[model samples]
Target: MSRPRVQFMRRPGRLMLSAVAAFAVVQLAGCGKQAAPDAETTATLIQPVARLDLKVAKAAPGSRSGEEIYQSVCVSCHGTGVLGAPKTGDAAAWAPRIAQGFDTLTQNAINGIRGMPPRGGGADLTDIEVQRAVAHLANTAGGNFTEPPVGQ
Candidate 1:
């Protein structure tokens, strides 16, 4: 008796069917019981990468103190003496300007000097506020300048 010979891939359709069946078996196997993520976990995974809070309280005009004004505006350049600006608390750098007197310094602050914007770049600042900031900055560098009283 002779045995029969069988070839597996003799038909292209059989090969395609075998591949589809194998894929379905794999897909079914992957459907095993798996714990679903909780709401909080899913939310965290899809949450925004960054967030900003811009709700800052602001003081009324002429009410903010000299220190407050410096910290808010003048500090940008004066704090580091950037672009020839005299750094805060540097007596030598402030000596020439201080010698020019308080009025001169106040004027310079109110009307923009080299590298320094008018009112220290604080457009909302009143003249008195500018005066106060100037006195504060000048006094910090060994000058005895007087700042206008608050709310003036």
Candidate 2:
């Protein structure tokens, strides 16, 4: 009679669980001289990291169209007017900024405004692409500016 040997990793679910446990232990262990909370702490600690990973993964790609860049990057802050950003298509909000003139607005967008990061947080966007996106947002908000063609 022969006995069967079971390898731990031969079971994918078990391997995954083991890996997660190991990760939780390593994460908790890094804290100095603190008592670790049991199983529930692992899930709580992992959730924020997972959310941040998804945010980084969703970062905008380079050389996209104005609308695409707006949808991917600008929408996060601009669409909802987060952090004092003017909401897209808000005529009243865009009024003062439009009065600043197109060049100044695009320059601010390119250089980072009070709450906005440079290039509307799409660090990979080309200068012209950013300009186009600025125009797109401005137009949607009732401005009549025209975006220059790419490369000039």
Best by TM-score: 1
Report the C-alpha lDDT of model 2 over 53-82, residue by residue, as the tens digit.
Answer: 344454344445678778987999988889
Per-model C-alpha lDDT, please? 0.91, 0.84
Tens digit of per-residue lDDT, candidate 1, span 44-65? 8998999988997778899988
**Which residue pairs overlap in candidate 2's backbone?**
none
Lowest-sum lDDT 10-residue window in model 2: 52-61
Model 1 lDDT at residue 1: 94
Task: Please report how far candidate 2 places residue 108 from its true position, in Å.
Answer: 0.3
TM-score of 1: 0.70
TM-score per candidate, chains pooled? 0.70, 0.57
Q: Which stretches of candidate 2 lie over 4 Å from their true place?
A: 1-62, 150-152
